[model samples]
Target: MCDAGLKLPPNNEKLQREEEEVMHGANLTLKLNFPQYQSEVEELSVKSSTEVGYVKLLIGQRKGITAKNIRIFYNGTQMIDPMSLCDHLGVSPPSIDVDVYINLEHTIDV
Candidate 1:
């Protein structure tokens, strides 16, 4: 359901806007899960061109943890930074639903 006050753009204009977004970058909704934190889940809407590192930064800001302390996983495999969500998900669309796991218990030994 859309807001009653919200008005959709004209067909042509809407098409043009969509084309522009496709040319630039689309947005995606990702499910961020914190398995160690009560199975907490949060929905993150970000541009497809966004990197996993940025997502981690966002999550860290929300969780009050350092970005370097967060680990991201997709489909049970660890995700690396510098990889766009579009390339990671391998989908072409403005909207897509994907799940990502967050591990906060990772420790680094100096």
Candidate 2:
């Protein structure tokens, strides 16, 4: 390996591009309309697996229902679980903070 006598050029442009990519994640809009759950949630942080669990538990408390029925949507994709969802979307699970939708079925209009 080269010592202090030699150094490689830094890639400032590459680093900047990476940072911009990280901030380019999409936002989701959840529409939770369960009458029993009067709690309002404009955003939910989901950055990790634990955060996913936290969201699931939080939903249970607010909606008085289990997490099984909870499904998240972003763009045209359906987030069914924490791992697959986060990995596929390249988004920190916790960074997902948009209006949380409840009791609304996802559909595509003609």
Candidate 3:
């Protein structure tokens, strides 16, 4: 597992252009579901350029959990921290509504 808080400089112009292109004409929304908690479903309005790890941090603050303890899943798979929300959704303009599951269980190594 990689550090979720790692930050990288935008050294490639092509990547920046691609990111802007995906976010050009759409509003992104991330619907977060917490199965183990009673909190009502939370929705985050974001851009396609938004990072999944950032969303996890926001969820952590709202739920009183550490950001490292939060795991985001889209379409039943874990999301990489550095990937943008749009890439994870794999839509050209991205869906206005994106659903992500929040897992709070901590992993243990034997």
Candidate 4:
């Protein structure tokens, strides 16, 4: 219990490191192509179990935009399920490429 009467979780660095190491093993390298933005391409590494919405969040952070404005596509099909895992969407194995499209109104050249 802390001074505020709230129980704090254990700050075990070793446990956190172990968990990170485990997750690292499942990381997938993805090639992101921005066809709507000068045909720009970027590589990103994420966990295989990562959700589509989280991918948008990651890209949004780098592009200074919100996740809601980003759209991800695979195999010429738009990934509509934000909660779907990347691997399940067939965007895994590190060889598949993902297409990212941003709304023209909110597009930022980056």
Top candidate, metric TM-score: 1
**Lowest summed lDDT over 10 consecutive residues: which window, candidate 2?**
26-35
Which residue pairs collide, candidate 4?
none
What is the lDDT of every predicted structure here? Answer: 0.70, 0.48, 0.65, 0.76
Deviation in Å, model 3, residue 77 alpha carbon:
1.1
Question: For residues 25-85, could you state the per-residue lDDT of candidate 1 as single tens digits?
Answer: 7767777776776667788888777887898889878877667877777666667878876
Deviation in Å, model 3, residue 80 alpha carbon: 0.8
Off by over 4 Å in 2: 1-40, 51-54, 82-85, 97-110
lDDT of 1: 0.70
State the lDDT at 2 in candidate 3.
Answer: 75
User: Per-residue CA lDDT of candidate 3, range 3-108, in tens?
Assistant: 8896997699878876776555346667666655655567877776677788778877776666677777776777788887767655334343334454436523
Best by lDDT: 4
Q: What's the TM-score of each model vs. the native?
A: 0.67, 0.40, 0.58, 0.66
* Candidate order (lDDT): 4, 1, 3, 2
In candidate 1, clashing pairs total: 0
Backbone clashes (count) for model 4 = 0
lDDT of 4 by residue, 1-110 (tens): 55777686689997786687466535677789999877699998877667788889899999888888898888988876545445454555545688898886866555
For model 2, residues 48-75, the per-residue Cα lDDT tens digits are 4333445656776666666654655555
TM-score of 2: 0.40
lDDT, residue 40, model 3: 52
